[model samples]
Target: MDCRRLGEAGPVVSRVAFGNSLTAGNQLADDSAVACVRAALEAGITTFDTADVYSDGRAEEVLGAALSTVPRDRVVICTKVGRGAGGGAGGLAPERIRSCLDASLKRLGTDYLDLYQAHLYDDATPLEETMRGFAEAVAAGKVRAVGVSEWAADELAEGARLAREMGVPLVSNQPQYNMLWRVIEREVIPACEPLGIGQVVWSPLAGGVLSGKYRPGAALPEGSRAVAAKGGDNSLRRWKFLQDDTLERVQRLRPLAAEAGLTLPQLALAWTLHHPTVTSAVIGASSPAQIAGNLKALDVALEPDLLVAVDEVLADSVVRDPDLTLSRMLRRPRQA
Candidate 1:
């Protein structure tokens, strides 16, 4: 697989980072999750992303166990902290940040994280306080670089300015970006471009909707995320990615993928990497083969005309309003 520097100040990472958010102890069995992580390593993926709240923190345990077999220096481990750190304390308050960082370190079985991100901005905490907490982690050698996820364009600029003042290397921002989801392009990308912060995008395949597996007229596939995630945060009904119009538009891209000598999922994954500001596309997998299949995206280069064609096909089906990029966590009360 290809590699890219995460940002001007961050470590170089694989073009495709493995995301343990969904599969770790949630979608896949322990042994199976371990095997999938090992498969990512075998496929040359060196960056692994997880979060403390994923699967109630079991994701970190599963990912840590999988990475223990390899030399620590060989991989770039990235994880986020923001939600509650347990015991009812959460948000990006200085104390909460410190406590969550320590707990994440313990769960991941690592002394320091290569990339430590605020999973979501804390509306209740002062931005300086949050950046100060991350700055302290860097000073204490508990984290290599600081980053944020799902922050708005203005939030990123303000945070980046604060981090610079605090001597913190604010590097990357994690956001949901895919062929059909263009919310970040309107403001977030332009805001981060000059600041030297690159994007580590999630849901590149739009939660598998871009993979062309969800047919317009067919019943929801058995055991699919849409089926398994029913009535929850990831439920298909909540996200509306399974709508027939969207699926039909996604299906139109099949021939384009064929022409590019790639699978539908490969086309979806490759489309995300086409952006120069994208550091890596995070791929979450339920099996080893899934990781292996996505690795091919690093090699499939989409022509400019093909990209335009994609835009034309998905036209109105795309979601580009920057207002939609705000974090749902903004509604949560302040953490004590």
Candidate 2:
């Protein structure tokens, strides 16, 4: 497995991390979840991402079992707090953060988490308290490093200040970043750049919308997130990225992936890693083969002109603008 550093003096994990969302079971049979983990380990995907809020904690349970198949030190385990594994944003009180990390450790059946991330930015929870809680976890040897997710520039900066004050190392920021969701580049990416914080972008596949299965007007495929009853409302903030223009771009990229001997998903993931700001790209797979396909995307660089060609397709479309309007698009923190 190819390893990437989560900033300086922090954990180095597999570039292709195993990501499990609430619906991992949708893609894998009950037995395959564990099987996928084992397969990922054998395939050298040493970084594993799970969250307390995924499937009300069932995802974590499944992930823990899979990691248990391998010795602990050989693999890097990453899980998140702040959002209840049940899927609601939980206030990050000191006690809540501590309790959540402890519970995640217990559920994952590990003594310490290699990377413990805040699932979301809990505005209601003071940034100081949350950073201190994660720092304390590191100090207590219960966590190897601290990280955050879905945070904007200021929020990431705040965490950095607090981590420095508390003498804790804040290592990374994981966000939803893909060719289709480049919004982080405008806000989140610039913030973390100077700090030397690694960026592990989740949803590099845009919730599977970038996998070339969806079309302009075709019926949704089986197991696609868009087909889920609740997928639309939860992801409405990102609906534009899945529009006709995005699909057209994905179609155009078929030749690119074919040229690289990869699939559309591989092409998309490779395109994401081309960014200098990204440290690693988190990939969620329902099956072992999906993870296997994604692993090959590492180091796949999209040339500048090909990237420009992809953007030309997006220029006129109403699809996602990648800026989330925070820096280039409209802001919606109030909606959350």
Candidate 2: misplaced stretches above 4 Å? 25-27, 85-90, 228-237, 316-336
lDDT of 1 at 220: 79
Model 1: CA > 4 A from native: 84-90, 229-235, 328-336
For residues 276-335, write the lDDT of model 1, one tens digit per residue. Answer: 889899988877888888778888778999999999999999988887775643454679
> By summed lDDT, which 10 consecutive residues of candidate 1 come out lowest?
229-238
- Candidate achieving the largest lDDT: 1
TM-score of each: 0.94, 0.89
Error of 2 at 127 (Å): 1.5
Global lDDT of each model?
0.87, 0.74
Tens-place lDDT digits, model 2, residues 45-149: 888898887776777888887777678888888988876433333457678888888888888899999888887776566777778787778889999888887
